[model samples]
Target: MTELLTVDGTQSALSQRYSSALMNTFGAPKRVLVRGEGAYLWDADGNKYLDLLGGLAVNCLGHAHPFVVSAVTSQLATLGHVSNFFASAPQIALAEKLLGLFDAPGKVFFTNSGTEANEAAFKITRRTGRTKIVSTVGAFHGRSMGALAVTWKPAYRELFAPLPGDVEFVPYGDAEALAAAVDDETAAVVLEPIQGENGVVVPPAGYLQAARRITSEHGALLWIDEIQTGIGRTGTWFAFEAEGITPDLVTVAKGLGAGIPIGACIGLGAAADLLQPGNHGTTFGGNPVAAIAGLAVLTVIERDGLLAQVNAVGNHLASSIIALDHRLIAGVRGRGLLLAIELTQPVSDQVAQLALEAGFVINNPIPNALRLAPPYILSKADADSFVAALPGLLDQVEAG
Candidate 1:
């Protein structure tokens, strides 16, 4: 057996070594993950952890799922990387499957990551002959130059000075603010149905519908960035579906391929034919292996009734967390599996670390918001176990 890794100073040593070798873009690395299976992961020193964050909401079916493994292995053995010049079975099939999920007719452009997907959509928006874009104040599109232009955080935008011009920011969930910003000159109004990176903030009722109407009236495209909220993460296939609105451009990634990196920028209605040949291209955008992995993920989600499971288990998990009756437990907020617990103090990260030491894995996206995006296939018992351990973790954070 591998020697167990301690969660204390020894882990700090390993982290220090990592900092020496790598540029610290994301500050220090969390515990070095060694292996993962189902909803659990093992650290470099072999300490087991219940991974509630799921690689920042990437692992929908969980880690090392047999279906995902088999699909990728078989596809690789048959045909791996081919250029976009040629079409692959899985590639075309996955695109068709995605279109089938949406009521609106559209076309898809695949990419290797969420940022790339948004970049492709950004270029498509430019093709509308309108350069202006309206986005939310706390929305996170991606890290690419074009995506960063529309992404609303000034800290992220200020560092990369001179982003693409004609972008406007409005307060999220405010239909009036969105209407005030979007006009006939605007190419698209981009939104996250629920702002994931801003700590799982769900919008007000009728917010999305109002945006759709306002953008439609302005002759502007309504783009919903579903990168972190799509593909069964929020119980619905797409969160916008729950709100009863169809966007002109929809970007998706993260859980689409379970872990295999893939993203799609889908254009609906009149926005479909904006890009022609030579408008955009990518080498590894829609690799057959990645597409096969996506098919496997979608297949499992439908076959195993994971959507219903997500709703049932998610409701229970959120209710249980709220029932803890601790001062730190302000409330549980979110839909489906994408839940966040608001802490009274700014010790959410401390609570997360303490929980990790106790073999539970969670994250604090904000100082007082503990985010949880466990696998769609997560069992009720596992969720209950985490809830049971929460009081102790809160106590540890409080003591510290």
Candidate 2:
């Protein structure tokens, strides 16, 4: 029989154990979480906290949702996984459903993560007989070699030198810069609509449309990385839907499976058949369990009208924070539940720690940006509570 650990064990003890055993990749964890429900998490010391980050914006239905739980359980009992050679009902159904969300004819290539999805799209772009890819600065596609080539962060790319070349970096949201960078030799123009990891920076109006127009004019494909902003995160099925432009390639992940690992690279129009056989594949992608989980998440979002809820709650939170009139809070950026509170001073790390002490879980994605990507199911009452506590949290950070 295995011995059960008690909550009396302090987080420091666990941190030491983790440091001794695990790789020094993520550094030391802040808390040892035991369980979660809805938008709350309980730590080893029995401290409960409102989870505003929502697993880095991947828990749209909150934690341990009943629909996802039941779907995963039933599907696992019936069919867990099979070779990609054999297709399951849920796999076909999910692909069809995702294509329907686009309201267009397209094909999907499933993967287990956002990086894999970008890698698959990278390969498809290569098939266009062009090697030049125009990407934006401050963009974070993924950590893989191919995806890393397009990511603009120097700290991440400097260590991993000699990445795949022929990729050009342009200033994000600058239509003229993007147009000047692209030509007939460009294979695709990859962009993230909101640049979530870069402190939720939203591009200027019509930026996406300009990219679309420019890519079309240059005979290059337009690829939108919607891994962080898709599937009801931005109060729409896809963020590009608001821009009224059809992209050649769309990559999505994060909240698609409502916590289960799944991602997709969707090729639209003629780009659908770009990758023929023997080009790309995955063993665990599109498996029955993850597909069912994604189906359950989509079903719950539509059935519960979570998109409208997200808009309402997100607006309230943003407005409330702005209403605080605190000198520390510079402004709020982003749409729907994907939001960032820009601080006048570089005290985001302190604010996140203070918020955690106040029973709220938030993230400091950058030095001066506090990001809040709470679940779509976050109640207005909980949002109001967070707003009520914001001023005090800022004061605490300022005091020190």
Candidate 3:
């Protein structure tokens, strides 16, 4: 057993240890979280906090869900890791389940994370015999070389020079811009149903349908990056369902396994056959453990009717936050549980810090945006508590 230590002492020790052993990729740690349940997390000193960001929208079922835990534990005892050379029941079952979620005929390629899923999709796009791929400005697909080539963030791409060429970027949600970007040479047009990293930015109505139309006109694949929006995060099984369009290719992760680390690249209709047997593969992509975790997440989401719950709770939360009438609050953006509180001033980081001190966790993706992506199972009372505290948190930030 370990002895208890003060919060500051424990946090400082962990930070020092991490700095000495780990790379400075993500900077210092915020706090040392010891435990989590549902929508709340406990720091080492026993300070409880409502987790509003849900680990960047990856913890749809929240931390340590019974279903996920049981599924992972059982799968590990039954069959843990297996090479791609052999097939597992959970793997095939998950693939079928993911394909069924689209309510269409398609194939799936599993991966360990969203970036790898995008990488696989990138390779599939190359199979179209066209080299050019058009993605939106302010769009984030992944960080790997192939996916990074399509990503628009200069800060991330600038350091990694000479990325895979033949990629173009156009303004997101601008139908005319996207229409002009895609041509016969374009292999695919990629987009996010709602941009999560970019302050939970929501595109104009019919934007996705417009992408589908434009890509169809140019004989290019329409790829929707649902890595941050899929698996009922946005109150729908897939965010694209609300757009009323079928994308040829879809990349998903984040919430699919409810923090179990799983991702998939799905191809619909003719695009299903784009990647042949020898085209792509991953050794641990379809491992039984991760597949079972994903299956359990889907099962629980359906069994608990969390999709409708997300829509109802998300609307209530947004309305409550807006009704606060705080001077700093500009507006709320995003759909379902994926939400962002737009601030009038560029003090989102301060607001987030204040919220954290007030026993709530939120994210400041940009200078003027505070993002909230609580778990699907988050109770109304918990949400109301956070809403009630928003005005006070904002007041603290404004004072300083």
Candidate 4:
């Protein structure tokens, strides 16, 4: 006979050791994940989970993809790290491939993470000699001090007082607000096509176009931060592609290296020349291994025709979830695989807990929103499984 225990539980041995050794910046992880293959993760307790969050939208190629692994291993064996003084084939090739995606000839500056990518863009904005930068509300560029300056969340910004000055915020999705905010003094207008961190809030149509017109009119560079929305996450190489406007600068990272650390600040047109020889630099920013990882990620996506797959699977996932007709669900909004399930009740956290216990990984980004940034490789069948289980989870949450 089993005894019913009232006390919840304690951390696993690995988790206990983690608490003592690692910083608590992210709090204690929900599960001590041991391994990953494809879109599934296994914890230390041998519990399997469907990874619907995709490492916060970083693992577009899924986990431990053989192509990326092979590319990184080969590059590391051949030429891993090189000072910025010397260039490598992978770095040059990756830069060229990235620039090819843009309409105009652009230059690429690689960084190790999304924050560093935004940091590079922030510095580029300063090169215009105009200190003021216009950022929209709900914007999340990164955590570094320079990137933090342009970010909108008060809680994230308050601790780091006096973040780079002369930054203004306008209401997102409001073209008129953007027009009113920009002026001759504005160096750049930073924006995210879809506000990823703010519960995957998508902007209305014509907003990006209006932004381009306003920034162009004011002579302010338009910097589009695509860290969370770019690299085929939106069924296109870049989310801004659907809008058909050329941005002065675009920063991408999350899915670029297939889980390896890599990000890039791509400057197009005249913005390409903004950064000169002495303007900026980094040690491992464009290391060959990271560059090769980026190359392999891109190559596989292209070879597999995954953009079409993303669109098909994303449409299917959204439609299937909506088809469930669950009363708790309000709707779903997003492009490609980066979607958000809007809950009628503010019980997303509870629903997420239920989802985890049911062997699914999800994120309650906001009280009423559950964000899903699953890997591009996620099949319709896999998506259907989640959709099938969702009703039961919601029922459990609603009951409680």
Highest TM-score: which candidate? Answer: 2
Model 3 misplaced stretches (Cα beyond 4 Å): 1-9
What residue runs in model 4 are displaced by over 4 Å at the alpha carbon?
Answer: 1-11
Global local distance difference test of model 3? 0.92
Between candidates 1 and 2, which one is better according to lDDT? 2
1-400, model 4: which lDDT tens digit per residue? Answer: 7867332333387787778999999888798887899999988777899999999999999999998988899888899898999999999999999999888999999999999999999999999999999998889999999999999999999999989999999999999999999999999999999999999999999999999999999899999999999999999999999999999999999899988899999999999999999999999997999999999999999999999999999999999999999999999999999999999999999999999999999999889999999999999989999999999999998788
Q: Local distance difference test, per candidate?
A: 0.91, 0.94, 0.92, 0.93
lDDT of 1 by residue, 39-101 (tens): 999987789999899998999999999999999999999999999989999999999999999
Candidate 1 is scored at a TM of 0.96
**Once all C-alphas are superposed, what RMSD does model 1 give against the true structure?**
3.0
When 2 and 4 are scored with TM-score, the better candidate is: 2
Global local distance difference test of model 1: 0.91
Worst 10 residues of 2 by lDDT: 1-10
User: Which candidate do you rate higher for TM-score, 1 or 2?
Assistant: 2
lDDT tens per residue, model 2, 1-400: 7759655567788778889999998978988898899999998778999999999989999999998999999999999999899999999999999999875699999999999999999999999999999999899999999999999999999999999999999999999999999999999999999998889999999999999999999999999999999999999988988899999999999999989999999999989999999999999998999999989999999999999999999999999999999999999999999999999999999999999999999999899999999999999999999999999999887787
Root-mean-square deviation (CA) per prediction: 3.0, 1.5, 2.1, 5.0
How do the residues 72-99 of candidate 3 rate in per-residue lDDT, one tens digit apiece? 9998999999899899999999999999
- In terms of TM-score, how similar is model 2 to the real structure? 0.98
Our tally of clashes for model 3 stands at 0
Question: lDDT, candidate 1, residue 392?
Answer: 85
Q: What's the distance in Å from true for residue 257, model 4? A: 0.5
Question: For model 2, what is the C-alpha lDDT against the true structure?
Answer: 0.94
The Cα error of candidate 1 at residue 303, in Å, is: 0.5
